[model samples]
Target: MSPRTEQQYEEIREEKKKLIMDTALQLFANEGYHNTSIDQIARTAGISKGLIYNYFTSKEQLLQSLIFSGFDEFAQFFDPNRDGVIEKEELHYLLREMFKLLKEKMSVWKLYFGIMLQPQVMKMVEKEVYQYALPYLKLLVDYFKKEGKENPYLEARFLSAVGDGIGMHYITDPDNFPLEECVEKLIALYQ
Candidate 1:
């Protein structure tokens, strides 16, 4: 076999990193982050404990990576055109896509809500969470302002709270949550 190239090595590294993150997400969501150990994740991923350290400086860093990755995935749906303004159709698209993502990545969202409910875990990541959230909140406020809402910031916050409630309920009872209907109502509300 020909010697592996640099690109091949990078691909292997990325695959291993994803494997570790995926395993960690499962354990953190189902088993609780504090209860899950690095050794446990390494064993689950079929890698050495040391390998995880190579990818992440610490377990907290790994958790942060998982959380940040989910935020990054969400960024794509928020402002696809990179334009400052959010049109009505764009708002609708964002809601539809957000629900689709929640359905598709239940485990990730479960971890998110799980972390938020745990005061300690939430404290650990609060700054980073706010860092990711502020821009999106600003965009929503701007959109609501353009829509002539008297309390655009409040409207933005209300929509965020609603989204969080929907996500929490859907994750808790996905089989009968009426997610599509909720999404339709949310879209209409914003319009």
Candidate 2:
């Protein structure tokens, strides 16, 4: 095979990996992460379980991949370079964007919610800050610091709790949940 053929093959492999991730997240969200097995993911993706092993060594690794991919996508949207003096509109946009993504990305976020309660995933999350949601908390803290706000870590933690509340409601009823109204109420809490 030519070099171009090899590159095409690699691209196909990456695409397959992404499909597997999407299927895994969907199943995990709908079925609950604890109930989702590697075999189930493989079946949902229409691939053999053995083929999944070619992409991910284990189910945990697959879950981690979904988490990291989401992190990377949103990091840019939040503007890490901002001075942290977010205006009300920025806050609204943030709230809206978060709710929207969290809705569309329900499976991934659902897996994340469960992962936090799992001992092994929690440890892995702390140890690999670059690869998980810990960076978001850290980013919030640092942003607050740049703005001369007090106790950024505490503020970040508090916001995380608030987010969880809002997220839980949405995840529980994605079909008819009034996320926009909920977000308005959520932002009003800060007012």
Candidate 3:
């Protein structure tokens, strides 16, 4: 074959990076981050350990990328810039979509929940998460403000805490969790 064009090279690079990311995410989700090593990730990905290093400097960086990637996907789903004011139906749609994503990505959510409970891991990821999360939180605050709720900021915080608590419950007891009903009740109570 003639030398590959720049586009072909980029395509190959992206494919390899995605393979590495998917393999690492599955491993991290199934096994705790501290338990999973670069060698394990590389072996699981069917790549050499050194190749993994070429993509990610360390396992911690790999984990951060996985977390950030999930958030990026979430941002795409929500698309925070597309509206004038948030309506109750719109909020409900958002919550339902979120629940769908959570169920679909249960393993990743489990890995995320586990990491957040560990102080050291939390320290490493807290800033990045807050940065990613701020826009969504602000969206909620804006919704409440538009609804004429007093202390919209505090209400937004309360709603966020409730959502987190509900998520933890769902993550721990997914089979038995009445997610739709719970979400409906939350909407009923808040809206």
Candidate 4:
């Protein structure tokens, strides 16, 4: 076989990193983050424990990475145009896409809410979470204001809480959560 090029090596690295993260996310979601050990993740991924360290400095870092990856995925649906404004159509689009993502990546969202419910685990990444969310929060507030909501900030927060509740409930009972109906209602409310 020809010697692997730098690009090939990079691809291998990314694949392995994703494998580790995927394994960790599953274990964390099903087994609970604190109960899962690095050894378990390594065994599950079929990689040596040391290999995980090469990709992530620690298990905590791995958890943070998983959380951040989910955040990044969700961010794409929020402001696709990068125009710093969300039109009514854009708001509906965001709601539809967000629910689609939740359905498609159920395990990832389960892990996210699971982590958020655990105080100790959340503390490890709370600052970063707020940093990541602040801009989006501002955007929501701006959108609500533009929509002529009397209390835009409160409206934004209420919407956020509603999203969180929907995610929590859907993950808890995905088989009968009426997810599509809920998304439709949310879109209507925002409109």
Clashes of each: 0, 0, 0, 0
Q: Which regions of candidate 4 deviate over 4 angstroms?
A: 1-4
Q: Per-residue lDDT of 127-164 in model 2, one digit per residue for the tens?
A: 65444456567666765666577887887788878888
Worst 10 residues of 2 by lDDT: 126-135
Which is the winner by TM-score between candidate 1 and candidate 2? 1
- Write candidate 4's Cα lDDT for 1-191 as tens digits: 65998899999999999999999999998898889999999999999999999999988889999999988877766654387788889788877888898899988899988988889988998998898788878988999899898999999899989998998999999999999999898878865
Q: Rate the local accuracy (lDDT) of all candidates.
A: 0.90, 0.76, 0.86, 0.89
Task: In candidate 3, list every pair of residues with a backbone clash.
Answer: none
Which regions in candidate 1 have their CA more than 4 angstroms from the true location?
1-5
Q: How well does each candidate superpose onto the true structure, as a TM-score?
A: 0.90, 0.80, 0.91, 0.91
List all candidate RMSDs to the true structure. 2.3, 3.1, 1.8, 2.2
lDDT of candidate 3 at residue 54, scale 0 to 100: 79
lDDT of 3 by residue, 138-185 (tens): 898999999898899998899888988888899889889998899888
How many clashing pairs in candidate 1? 0
Q: How displaced is residue 26 in candidate 4, in Å? A: 1.4
List, residue by residue over 102-143, the lDDT tens digit for candidate 1: 999998999999988889888889998998888888888999
